[model samples]
Target: MTTSSNSPPLTPWGAAIITGVLLFLGYVGFDQFYLEWIFLLPLLWAIRDVRPRRAFLLGWVAGIVGHGGGFYWIIQMFQQFAGAPLPVGIVGLVLLAAANGVVLAVWAWGVSLLTRGRERHLVWIAPVLWTAIEKVWPEVFPNYLGASQYKVPHLTQIADFTGVLGVSFLVVYINATLYRILACRFEGKGVPWRAAAALGVTLVLVVAYGEFRIREVDGKVAAAQHLTVGLVQTNRGAADLHLSAGAIQQEHRDMSKALLAAKKADLVVWPEGVLSLGLPSREGTIPTWALGDLKVPLLFGACLQLNEEGETRFYNSALLADASGKILGTYDKTVLVPFGEYIPFGDVFPVLYAWSPYSSKFFSGKSVEPLKLGPHLLSVSICYEDIFPTHIRKLMRGGSEGRTPAVMFNLTNDSWYGNSTEPMEHLALASFRSIENRRSLVRVTNTGISAFVDPAGRITSRTGVWTREVLVDRVPLLEGTTVYGAFGDWIGWLCAVISLGAITLVTVSNRRDLTGKQNAL
Candidate 1:
């Protein structure tokens, strides 16, 4: 009896873990794209008619297992690059997993509260709840649920206006509809036409939007000005910094020279921090022409340190140079990485600052600045800055002090993730930024998946992973900004507002019912 009492809860634990596996198969991974449409069914079934607390626990398990599985590469990133101890890296991953699991736990709690001891019509409210949580999620390191369907062009078309939140809502709404229909059937009740109708209407609208948007884009692309842009993938990683920068610079020069000799490009872009070692001054007697003197201009990322007033300042900078090797202009990187670039809350906790790989703090650029390159000006984003949609739009806006660019350039180095799904995931999320602004995006990565993405979020030219290559493709420069650019993330805000308003109404209704019943008794 004493031994049995000391034993752990195997049955419940097993159920939770199993639910997580189901979620993973249904989400995204290794040719499981078709399974996404029905992924939530099993998780919903397991927690069906369960106590609110139990449901929340199950949801947390499923969330952690599924989401963590998608981003498991994070552990390798922490251990290998961030210099975290193996045990510490695992702990950090577990903590991240727990944080993600909490999002689903809260979602499950809402569902259980709404359906407990009452008709489950409120199950359809899952869309509202999901969109609300995702809207406020920090963009510093964003991972979207909708990114799972990135390969499906028709589904991603609506992202221009609704952003990724619209896609996430559609996914959850479908799950809710399926669960409700099945539950009603199991209970020997008539079919819920209202829930089915809502689901059908939502699908129809989404499909219709895709068709309309694609038609408009096709017409514009047919008659647009096509400019040849050269993208060089250095086949390098951040770890390569341990080696001398001369060899790395030589590789870039050789690649660019070969591509230029083969087909002359109007503009050439290199990956983030590709020229970190240092380039000699253009005015110096022995000036370095890394890419050789070409007809086309060059743009590349580097770290620039200079004195401002009495102090020294450091910047993650992108420099644009003319064909004659004259420095045109420089765009400083804004939206610096939290712990990676600078230690967060380091002033209060000095130990955290001491733990960083670098001693100097990188100063964030205050405004968006576009670089002039012959016929077109290019809006520049460095490293992880493109991940934030809001920040990207500000760069496109050309505010009062800035000029709008004909094209957008994301100089990134996703090589940090090694050979992982993160590179592809980042690519998918970056696509939306192009559609939202209705401008062509030139994404040049150090390793692979370097491509020319059109205004429609379609990849016209892309290179494979872990390869050394250069992609020279004709990309159309789109005119006029998208509605999403003018007014950003309105749909996300609206959905959040609707969810809060509905919750308030439900709480008031429940209280009124309780009061009436008490008086009658």
Candidate 2:
């Protein structure tokens, strides 16, 4: 790790910095241009000639740079939207980005140790190790690099069986292959034509498979049901959302009236946290009757409290009601938002609560069961839950049992990001979930991008942003499961195993070569 005087020096530390910048640029560039993927190359490059500790540090730096740059708008979400002060909001964003970066840093450290002297082969090992890390790392900032691929339908077809992990694996592997070819050419070493060829073949296969799946799913027309769905978009900003108790209740009432007047739809949906006033099940709390007159089974989001064994538990929940405004069944949000809903390791980080929006502790749901509504079985996804592909598959499969459920419902409030690309990005991810599970998704949003996506990831209908509008559309209730829904995330697991096995083989071969060299000396 030294440099020349005549030419610009490339120290290990300098390489680390370059790695971070390149990774950040790659992510930002890909996201802005929709270039499928390019971020994985920098991870391989960063650890190409580094020790384990340095590799870990480089990876961490790269992760922070990439996430911090890509999701910087999240700070606006915390400050202008969630009503936090500017300094605290910036710190929260940095903490989140760094925390996510730690996962990649660990992966780099592990791979560097395994391939100490065999840096040239990092192009093969780093991607697989990183993919495995991303797949198994329990929901600490669950939205990773590949999660952004939800919008690229052609590439996301692989998610059917592998979930999002499969897409991550493929993207990293492609980047690794490209890096290998370039490195070989740069050093005057013979080009790794095999790596280049393999990459080309894999791309073709992915594209071909995606094309086939698209055609197959598109050809089968869903028998359009006559059921009319009314989607309510509140268009309320974060400041408006956190108004006084009386004002909050009044807002819910006005939104309810707008939804009720929209049409005589069979089912009406509301965004997440529309009724943040209080839980309806709690004592002295305003009931659903106070909101508006309902004519059908209304599925709306609210904070609810349930008593179990004389103890009251509060939840961010979605409740279903009949035409007479009688409560039917309630679905508590199963996958809770990390810092937003409940802080992780709250025992250790007591001060974190001061920055959160909730005044009290939030309880997570015990199950991912679908609520029964007349003849239809509905699976519910609250806010960020829609981004997790496996969660949706499990919900649909668990709910469907042996028969196909009527539809999937998502209740979300994207007002956190205000008027940015976040809302559109969120909608794009939801579309992939719909396609992957072969189900129609009905999304009701607080701010904008409320719409209906059919089984093939096509937006059948949508609403304008920052507008108080109710959209009624006839959506098809899909029957039968896709290959992804049936098999779950086994494909991703298999890819991960293969990746690990490759790393093991490379490490063993390199170790043997080192031993032979020492003996000869």
lDDT for each candidate structure: 0.74, 0.70
lDDT of 1: 0.74
- Writing each residue's lDDT as its tens digit, candidate 2 over 1-521 gives 11112223344445555555555444422454233255555456557656777778877876787667756767877665445788978997798789887776877787777766565665667566767778666654465455556556777787666666677778777767776776677667878877778888888998898888778767655444546788777677655765754565566566656766756678888888766434436233234565566656778888776676678777888877777777677777888766666778764888877756553467877666677777777888898888887778878875535555668899998887767667766777677777778777999887888999877677788998788777888766656777778877675566568766766776798789899999999
Put down candidate 1 lDDT per residue, 368-401, tens digits, no spaces: 7677776677789987677688889898887564
What 10-residue stretch in candidate 2 is worst by lDDT? 1-10
Q: Model 2, which residues run further than 4 Å from truth? A: 1-30, 33-36, 76-84, 110-124, 224-226, 244-264, 276-291, 345-359, 399-404, 495-521
Q: Which stretches of candidate 1 lie over 4 Å from their true place?
A: 1-19, 22-31, 117-120, 277-288, 358-360, 401-404, 508-521
**Local error of candidate 2 at residue 257 (angstroms):** 5.4
Model 2, global lDDT: 0.70
TM-scores of the candidates are: 0.90, 0.83
Please give the TM-score that candidate 2 achieves against the real structure.
0.83
